[model samples]
Target chain A: MNTIRLAVDGVNKIYAGQATRVVAVEDASAAFAEGSVTAIMGPSGSGKTTLLSILGLILKPSNGRVTLMGRDVTDLDEARLPELRRQHIGFIFQSFNLFSALSALENVLVALQLKKVARPEAEAAARSALSRVGLEQRMRFYPRDLSGGEKQRVSIARALATNAPIILADEPTANLDSHTGLAIIDLLAELAREQGRTVVVVTHDTRMQEHVDHTLRMEDGRVYEN
Target chain B: MTYPVPMARRNLFHERVRLAITLVGIAFSVVLILVQMGVYLGMMNNTSSIIDHTEADLWVTARNNSNFDFSLPFPEHRENTAKGVEDVLWVKKFILVWSLMKLDGGGSENVEIVGFDPETGIGGPWEMVAGDPRDVKYPKGVIVDESSFAKLGVAKVGDDREIYGSRVRVVGICRGAKRITTAPILFTSYKTAQELNPWMAGKTVFLLVKTAPGADVAEVQQRLRAVMNLEDVYTQADFAWATKKYWTLSTGIGLGFGFTILMAIFVGAVIVSQTIYSATIEHLREFGTLKALGAENRTVYGIILQQALLSGLMGYAIGLAINLVISDLYRRTGQLVVQPWQLFAADLVVTLATCVAASLISVRRAMQVDPMEVFRA
Candidate 1:
């Protein structure tokens, strides 16, 4: 059996307002194994993104415990949580989220620099990461100069450059055409399987299930595995 | 890990038009504050230059003398009394009178008539740009400052001008004898000044006393005060301070300059804060992305602070370069000017502080950026 790189037990997330309380995730529990690709699939408002956010440590559960590499982080202080996130988690956003001011190589290098990698090594690592995504030729282009697939590839390179064991991608293919989206998913799955890192992708695209080791369907804030 | 410098430079330079406008605003504020301060300093220097440049160790004036502008005169015998004081190597009778000058053309100009004893040449124009100081001893002789040559309608030595209807020849021309009262000054012998202003015939407005080397100035002042019995005894520095204090605090010029300075500061802070705040808002999503990438609040603050300081530094350099040109223009106007290094250093600190203060609003907004927006968007 593969080692479980991350797990969340009985996690719940709710947004409280003066007049109402909205529950984003309810009793969502799942274990993502190392060296495998997992897809959390659900329709809109089904809490798939919320579960991904919680797993990425961007949002804290209203009630639950989170385990990362065998350590519980449910009670981690907010001040120290970012440091922990930088050291362990890498994220690929739906909008690509590349810094428009930076070139593709700098976008990746900035992420590595934030991860506390030295400049010289960060440059080498950024180049290698961009090459891994077949974007070496486009590494010097700004996000505005690049196409949709190129931008997505730059973000993937940014996430990969961090060398974190857990990569969380939210609706990674939502803005891409099917062919480009499939190509990205295939690259991600191969990188995860070959590099022994866990990749959890949140999506409603049923085609994503074909390339992942397992699919966990989310509905109304609840999770069920297939 | 530490891309604050590059990040700030890129962010500020991204929009060239906005960047130029922001820099211009900052530079204008700096220049306004600096020029206002320079003018005030120039005014102070003009007010005290007569005393500062003179070679007198002790000055004796009327007991309630407010300033050189409206000086009160005492009996000429006070000079003899001061001369008797121990350590008083020499004493010269000094006179000052405000009189109308009969210009060569139709109109008349206001003139400050300053008279010093020709024997000692004390309290006389020190910077002789042309001609000899001794020539003022000639009949109805006078010396005009080079800076006031154009205003006095005289070109060179041997040029003639009339003061209080007396045709006085400009025996010499000197520089840096600046006027604070907006009137050009004409230097003459005590006898000629006394003859011109009959009211000053038997009186002297001031006694310029020189002390021997190693003589205690305070002791000489004490002895002169006791000997004269009715005049105020002042060291050179005390009289200069008194003159400066009267012009700066007694008059409203200081308040006017001070108010303008505060306004400049307000305008600068507003412009800088608005520019930086607007830029931050424009890049709100970028900062959100940084937070999502696990950057701490301190990191965001660092970035904003770096941006502000960068603008301040560049703006300050540009402002100073412009000030150099402005100072030259001011110098041509014949105003007393001094820009010590300390002023530049202090202004630099103030400029940086202004920029830092202006960045607080932006930094607060930047720190509150929600990393979740990167995903939600």
Candidate 2:
């Protein structure tokens, strides 16, 4: 039994208003073990992103117990979650959420700074991570200076530099063409295997299915019957 | 993802157009705060300097008078009555009046005339640029501030000029002389001034004195106030405050600056708030994406805060530089001067206000973003 990197137990999330509670995640349970790539595949209006949000600690679940390496972190206060994410989790967004003014290395360096690494060491690690994604030549260039595929690559390096035990990516390949999407999926698979970390991707793109070690598909805020 | 400081800086300089627009807005406020506050503080300092340059502690004037430097025709014996007060070190008689001075082309303009005792030279002149301050100790000798001479076309040291129908030779230039009641003051011995205006012998303007250190000025003031029975008595600092209160608070200077300073703060707050709000609005989708990808609420909060902090600090720095340069330009024109403490206070207020405004923007927008929007169309 390898260490369970992330485990979500029957998470139920609802968007509540003055009059009603709209259920977004309904009793979804999931486990992403260490050294595995997990995908939550779904169509539009499906609960994949909501489940991912609950798993990522961005949204509080109405009923759930989240365990990282078998520690019940459900009732953990919101303030402690940032430090938790920095230590054990890496996040990648489809929009390449890198700050536009910072160079590629700086974008990754920012993540490292969050990880609480010293300045020089963070910079050196950022450079190596960019080289890992084959963007060594693009380190000094800003996001505006990068192309679509190159930007995604820098973001991937940022995830790598974070060096978290788990990487949570939301449609990391959405902005790229098929070739670039394939490269990113393959890169994520390589990163999981090489870094001995868990990767949880929330996406509808079936190109990720083959690279994923396990897939928990969702539909209409529930796990559809297989 | 986690820059503590530079995150805000990146957003500020990212778009030069926005940067320039934001800076212009901030600069208006900076200039406004600086000039208004400077004038407010400058008025106080000027009054203090006027007192410091004079060798007077106990001032005696005609009963119920407000101005210390203006001509108050008090009985000359009052100077001795003040000197007779316990612990009084020295007594010197002085006079302040305005008499028509003859300029070129037989033209005449009113010039402030200050007369001091030539022996003790109490309330003579200070800060000589071309010559000595002690040069004015000679009878019928004058020390004119450089600015006054600049207004008078082409005059130098050692020039003889008619002041109140008497010829007085210029001893030296008082380098940074300014207008008191909108007229330049010329320094001379009380004898020369009394000689020029014979009415002065009966009416002396000031009685200058010194005290031992640790002297209870309040008790001494009460004793003198009871004995002298003349104008209001005040300590040096109290006099400075009175002059500021008289010029700035009593006059329209305070009210004039109030509106402008408020407008400056409003401009600063509105521009900074709008910039931060604009950046927040622009990044909603990206924020959602970050949120969906396991970024905590604080993580998203940090991004917005970083942007706000960056813009505020940058704009403030740029605005301070501009204010300093503008202050120098004002100095060159010889109208205003800026003090370090005023500048520091303005900066502190502006930066703190900007940060608070930025925090408000971050809280408003960060709470509204839905994490699932990252995956939505």
Candidate 3:
């Protein structure tokens, strides 16, 4: 029997600007199990990214309880949230948020180092992660020197090096061509099936649905199974 | 071993031209302050060179005399009075006068004429490069410092020169007897110096007194003051300090250099702070990402501070190298480079202060960056 790695019950997110207030996520409930790849699909401004941000602990829901691996993290102290994210949740942004000055290997090493991994183990793990992403030869290249697909792959390696049980990717292939995007989706699916990791991907692209176990279609601020 | 250090170094060295310009600006400021400070220290050292080189327990000058160069003549019998003081080992009469030296081509140069009892070697020129101290015992014999050889237009020993219309022959060339006020020192016997200046014929300008070994110099100074009755008495060190104070505080040299150094510090700090701040701004996204990746605020601050310290160390080394070359080129002035250890120690303290102060704004900016911004497109 599979285990539930992350669950959000009656989650809501409201973004209040100086002149307006808009609800980004509303009463959304979802559960991601170990060894499953789930995609939250929606159009622009459909609150898909907000829901994923909540799941990654980047944003706290206005009214919700979030549990990760049997621990309730929704009410966790803000100071301790980063530690939780570092130990349990790995994040991949759409822009591939890689440090421009660091090489691909160093980029992956940063995540492991943040988890307080020893230097020797971190280096070996970084090399292995880059190699797993088919980027062993390009590990010394900086982000600026990388192509769109290679940069995204390096970001994937960085997230993977954290050894986090849950991986939250926000539109991981939005900037790539269809072929590259498909390859990235396949890579995420491989992590779920082969490594037994829980993967939740937020994107507007429906092509991502083909590789995941299921899709949750979000419209406005409400989420429903598709 | 820390992540911030390598990240900071890579960011600073990423653009070679920018890094070079930044280092040059910092080094230029460091040299500016050092040279200004060096000139001030050189002047202070020069004012005290005479007292420092001479060995004496007490100096008796005409009342109210502020420096040795400006001393006026008092009764010659005061030297005998100092000799009678308790613990006084011996006393010798000395004279100093500004004499006009007649050049071969009819050009005249003003030189400081110092006269001493050559037999006792009291108040005599120290560090002779050629000729003997006893050579000044000969009639019409004098000593000229090598530093003033070119200025006085004279060759080595045996060259005849006229001062105050009285003929004199150079018997020795000395080193390390450099004088401030741009006056070359000419050492001679007390009788010849008196013959050269008629107004000082029956008087002595200074009385050099030495106390017995194991004697307290301060007590001897007091005894000489009481015995002389109408002359100011000072130990050698005290007299040198008074001379230095006159030049440094009363002559406006100290204030002038102080202002320049202050301006250099401000200019150096401003340039470093702005450069580091802009560099941090350029890497704000990276900092935000690091924060989002669970790096603490201290870690981000470490990167800015590391960059500043590295810049300061490099700039200090470059500045000192360039200063040494400049000092060597102008060493003939004898007042350009004085104290090496003091200047280097002061440079280190100022450089660290400047660079550390410079990084504060950058560190603050880095900490203010929100990790959540990394999610923004």
- Highest DockQ, which number? 1
TM-score of each: 0.94, 0.84, 0.90
Judged by whole-model lDDT over C-alpha atoms, candidate 1 comes out at 0.85
Better of 2 and 3 by DockQ: 3
**Per-residue lDDT for B1-377 in model 1, tens only?**
33422778877887677778778877888888788888888888888887887789888899989677678988998777777778899888889888888877778888888898777677788888887777889998988877665766656788777767778888888877777777888788899889888888799999899998999999888888887778898999999998988998898988998898888778878888999999999888778877778888787788789889999998899989998888888877765557778888988888889999999999988877775777875
User: Pairs clashing in candidate 2?
Assistant: B8-B306, B8-B310
- The CA lDDT of each predicted structure is 0.85, 0.74, 0.84
Ranking by TM-score: 1, 3, 2
TM-score-superior candidate, 1 or 3: 1
DockQ, candidate no. 1: 0.58
- Clashes (backbone N, CA, C under 3 Å), per candidate, total 1, 2, 0
Q: Which candidate is the best by TM-score?
A: 1
Ranking according to DockQ, highest score first: 1, 3, 2
Write the number of the candidate with greater TM-score, choosing between 1 and 2.
1
lDDT of 3 by residue, A1-226 (tens): 6899999999999988999999999999999999999999988888988888788877889998898898899988887877888888887888999988788988898888778898888888888889888899998898989999999999999988878888989899999999999999999999999988899999878888788997999999999999
Instruction: Give per-residue CA lDDT, model 2, range B52-169, as digits (tens).
Output: 6776666555665555545368788777778788877777777877787788668777887777766665676667676665666666778787768654555578788886677878
